[model samples]
Target: MSDPVDFRDNRGVGTLISDLIQQVSSLMQTEIRLLRAEMGDKLKTMLGGAVEVLAGGLLLMAALLILLQALVVALAHWVGAGWASLIVGLVVAVIGVILVKRGTSNIEPSNLTPDQTTNQLARDAAVVKEQFK
Candidate 1:
């Protein structure tokens, strides 16, 4: 029976180092891809929040104009025209503030961060550190 030759005996330190470098390079590329994907998802979420804020602002503006006029006309009998208009304006402004606040909450720093990628990279670094030790 023929015996198989062992390849490990022929492998030098330089070859091992080269293989290590290649592995690290591949790992970095994969991490970068993951980072990009995570960032893209966060960006999409941010974009959705921004769109919601914009839509809310537009709706608020429309409501301010139309509802203000309607409310002012409706309540003008109970209060004077000017007081009714002022009250309506204040109410619409408050609602607009609430909508804006809700939309902006979704775009906070925490929500916009690539949390998964950050955690993954930290874990990877810890693993590499442990391996080196």
Candidate 2:
């Protein structure tokens, strides 16, 4: 009868180590690819939101201009045309300043950071450390 094969031999250990190395390498590559895809998706979403906000801001500016002109016209009956225009312009300028301040406050460096990716990477590192240990 043919000899039975020995499964837990030294050669088997070497093969297992080789397979482990290859698998770990492949896992790292897949993780990197996933990270890139996720970041790309996030960037696209952020860009789309920015475009929408820009369009809304432009429309709001147009509407504000029309309203300011209407206010000046209405005030002209009570005040002289020059004073009405000046008052309306001042009010619009003040409102614009307030809006600019609020808009700026909403935009900070932290808001632009890739928070999900950062968290995911930290988790991945922890898992790798545990696996190796």
> How many angstroms is residue 111 displaced in model 2 relative to the true structure, after the best TM-score fit?
5.6
TM-scores for the candidates: 0.71, 0.57
Model 1 per-residue lDDT tens digits across residues 82-104: 56666677677777777777789
| Local distance difference test, candidate 1 | 0.79
**Which of the numbered candidates is closest to the native, going by highest TM-score?**
1
Q: Where does candidate 2 stray beyond 4 Å?
A: 1-11, 77-120
